[model samples]
Target: MDQERARLLASVLAPGVSEYVVLLMEGDPASKARPRFGGGRTYKTAADTAAETATGWALRRSFRQPWTGNVGLGCVFFRPNRQRIDTDNLVKHVCDAGNGIAWVDDAQITAEFGVVELDVEHPRTLIVVTRHVSSLDRSDLVGTMPRPRRTR
Candidate 1:
């Protein structure tokens, strides 16, 4: 890892983070490809399979155990070119790659954020998984909105 990336990883892995893992994968970020159908079956493309395997390995190196509770997933994709790709697909690729490794399941992710940007020199993907904490409560809504009037 380069100096900048090392610094970033340090900051994210700092103290006070009770349950979290940060993975910095250095490679061409891959978007989730649509499954191909043939021979009365559906399967992922070779590129997608390779990408997921690589990503899963990286996740395993950083995450010790799967998080059982709801988690918040965040990803930043740095692409080598200005190619058009859906951010949601990129997020999905990472989420799927982490299944059974970083978390119990992708459905356990209750919150998510994703970003795609260009970085020709160092194309990579950075993913952060943190335990989700609900920031809102019924008390917070008190006096924040007007109550509906009863109909006659």
Candidate 2:
């Protein structure tokens, strides 16, 4: 995750609002993967099993990298109501988290997903999300995990 960007997001989002840094790609292209919003699977470690249950609207990595060649600490923001605007028409906006926050338009974004891996050295699809902007959430519309009835 980018320290500068993180700080900017923190500033722009509502106080206590959930935010995360995700690696996104466009059509699984190589050499042009950029950071996307927060939302992915839960892994104990970089190679751990995925969480049985999804947490909030996003999933973040365990930790962040500081002054290291390789770092993996992603974030996820779970806002079910946040309008999913078209990437093609995304506007360049900035947040107060720090200074890296910029309005990312759809044309600039290749694809959207929580990062599953981070190959900082090489350009790859390691950074991706299990959920897409199109994926709809049925949490509130339904109940928290369906309940089972007792049978005789």
Report the C-alpha lDDT of model 2 over 1-152, residue by residue, as the tens digit: 44464444333432343443444322211111133444584323321111111121112121121111111122322222334433221211111111111111122222232322233343322221111122232223222222332334
In order of listing, the candidates' clash counts read 0, 21
Give the number of the best model, judged by lDDT: 1
Q: Against the true structure, what is each candidate's TM-score?
A: 0.76, 0.21
Q: Give the C-alpha miss distance for residue 80 in model 1, angstroms.
A: 0.8
Q: For residues 93-145, could you state the per-residue lDDT of candidate 1 as single tens digits? A: 99999887777678777678787878999999878777665442222322332
* Candidate 1 stretches greater than 4 Å from native: 1-18, 135-152
Judged by TM-score, which candidate is best?
1
Residue 143 displacement (Å), model 1: 40
